[model samples]
Every structure is written in C-alpha cells, then in structure tokens.
Target: MRIYGPSGTTIGSPAGNTKRSGSTGFSLPDDAASTQATRPAAAPKAAANIDALLALQGIEEDPVERRKRSVQRGKGALDVLDDLKLGLLAGNFDASTVGRLREAAANLKASSGDPGLDAVLSEIELRVEVELAKAGQF
Candidate 1:
C-alpha cells in the first residue's frame, strides 16, 4: 500500500532522496532496515551491560559530594604526614607509624589547587617510601 498526500502525490517517492534505497521502494536500505528491526533484541542486552558496569564502578557520587570526599581524604593524609614529620624530627618513629604514612600516601589522591600542598604531599610520599625501604618493608 502507498500513501498519497493532499495533491495526490505518493508521499515516499524516491526522487533526490539519498536516505531511500531505490531498489527497496523508497524504504530504508537493506542493512539499515535489518539494524532497525533488530533493535528490540539488542536494547535489553545493552541496558543490562550498562547496569553491570555501573555496579562494578559503584554508585557515582554527585560532583559536590565527590569533591568534598576528596578534600577530606587529602586533609587526613596531610594530618598523618604532619605527625610523621614531627615524629621524624623528634627521632621517635616506629615502622608501623611509617607504614601508616605509606598507606596514606598510597591511597590518597587529591590536589587542593595549592602548589605548596601538592609539593608537601609528594615529599610525604617519598619520605615514607624511603623509611619503609630502610625498615626492609618495601
């Protein structure tokens, strides 16, 4: 069946239409038609795959919450590093204390947009790594 408009012209005539395949009677090309036809079967599988990926990544926090958490982690890492520095200066730090500092450096990753803070963080990580090596725990 063909549809005619008000002027009695077939609506889907293939003249000057690149979207239509002439051999397919002004319809979608064969490959495109097959793709459109198979969409329903693929949709559910695609959705399931996306859900699985999100699950693996964990629930995504909003930007504000993410930034806040990052800031908190950076703060905690800085605090621990401060104590380690003081302990070093005082000449009374144990292997486990250095281990905690190493763990902090390994896990924390945040830049407070301050170059000094980033430099201090790098120093802390390096200092902890050296201490761990000296203790034969690295």
Candidate 2:
C-alpha cells in the first residue's frame, strides 16, 4: 500500500495557503451581528452541566439494587396480603387495607430486571386483583 501525501509538500511551510477562500469562510447571522451578546460565563454553565450530569447519574438504578428493591416490595405486598387475610378472618378489614393492597399491586407492575422475580410478582398481583375483585373493590 502506497501512503500518499500532498505533492511537493515539505515539513516546513507546507502548502503555504494563508488566504481564506469564500467557500471556507463563515458569517454570523445579521441579527446576531447587530446585538451585544449577553452570554453567561463558561464556569457557571459548565458547573450547571456537570451538576445536571451528576444528578442524572444518581437517578439511574443499579440492576442489583433494583432487584433487591423489587424483592422487598414483593415481601411487603405479601405481608399486606397476610394482614388483609387476617383482618378478614377477624372481621376487621377496612377500606384502608384494601387501598394498601391496591397500591402494592400497582408497585408490583414495575420490572425487577429479573424474569423469575417478575413472573412471581405478576402472580402476586393477580392474586391481589382477585382478592380486590372478591371484595367488590375492583
């Protein structure tokens, strides 16, 4: 393979084209040229951008953490279901308990990034829905 460079070019003063061609030149917009630009300082803008990036990084959940959270939520939902069952058997269940079960069902809808866990949660949600439906709350 032949590596070709500019013809007749030397290390010093290569091509030596100092003039700007019309095709390569740039012009500002007429409105921009007429205004005194009031741009914010670079430091604050850079700081703001860095802060925003950090905030976004913080918002992203780790897969392991998300899975753990989903497990905890599932356990909580199961606990609530148990409480509801106990309440019903004891004839003390009320609207608030049903509301909590509904909320748990809603929370279960979020993905845990694990197919197995998701399947389990879906089953739990279905059970919750069935219970709610039986109670005429659905």
Candidate 3:
C-alpha cells in the first residue's frame, strides 16, 4: 500500500522548507489608530466595590454541597428525635434536647435544591414541630 502527500512535498521535508504562495503579511486599516485614540480609558474600580464583590463570591454556595449539608442536618434532627424518644422511655428527658430539636427544625427550613430531600426534610421538620408542640416548648 502507498500513502500519498501533497504534490511537490516529501515525507521527511522540514516545515521551514515549505513554499510560500501568498503575501502572509498583516496590516491594519488607516482608521485603526484613530479608533484607538477615540476610545475612553477604563475607570478605576473602588476598593469598597472590590471588597463587596469578593464577599459575594464567598457567599455563593455549591448546590450539591448544600444538599449534602441539608441531608446531614435532617439526619442529625432524626438522631435527636430518637434520643428524645429514648430519654422519654428512660424517664430522663431534658430541656436541652428540646432546644436542640428547635434549632434543627430551623436549620431544616433552608431548601436543599433536591425535590426528594426537601420533601423528606419537610417531613422531619413537621415531626419536630409536632414534638415541640406536644412538649409545649414550640
């Protein structure tokens, strides 16, 4: 089998040895200098604006990470509920556990951007509210 290359070309020819067929030169139009002269200089950015922009960038949270955090919070709330149950069964219930449950309920209010997880979290929040209401601590 034979492999063919362009006419007037050889397999081992150096790129520098290639023949030029056009001017290959670049030139700007006559109005290029006038356009550049007419353009306005960029204004300097304020320090306060730069600081605010940086702070806003830091404030943006990743969706997946936010979802994971929500799930963990839901699990934490569930664990607290289980503890509450065990405490009741053992006659060792305390006020701190209810306070933690209230905090968890508040944390569960933030959306996790996942439909299923948000639904589950809402259910957990509902249960927490119910427990808090029953204890008259809500």
For each candidate, what TM-score against the reference? Answer: 0.41, 0.56, 0.57
Candidate 2 lDDT by residue in tens digits, 43-95: 64345578788668747979898899899999989998999899889987688
Q: So what's the TM-score on candidate 3?
A: 0.57
List runs of model 1 lying over 4 Å from the truth: 1-57, 109-138
What's the lDDT of the predicted structure labeled candidate 1?
Answer: 0.61
Which candidate number maximizes TM-score?
3
| Residues forming the 10-long window of minimal summed lDDT in candidate 3 | 1-10
Q: Which stretches of candidate 3 lie over 4 Å from their true place?
A: 1-59
Question: Which lDDT values do the candidates have, in the order given?
Answer: 0.61, 0.79, 0.82
How do the residues 23-68 of candidate 3 rate in per-residue lDDT, one tens digit apiece? 8654444555466766588898757778788668647978888888
Candidate 1, residues 92-112: lDDT per residue as tens digits? 876667667677767555554
lDDT, model 1, position 69: 57
User: Candidate 2's C-alpha lDDT?
Assistant: 0.79
Residue 13 displacement in candidate 1 (angstroms): 82
Judging by lDDT against the true structure, name the best candidate.
3
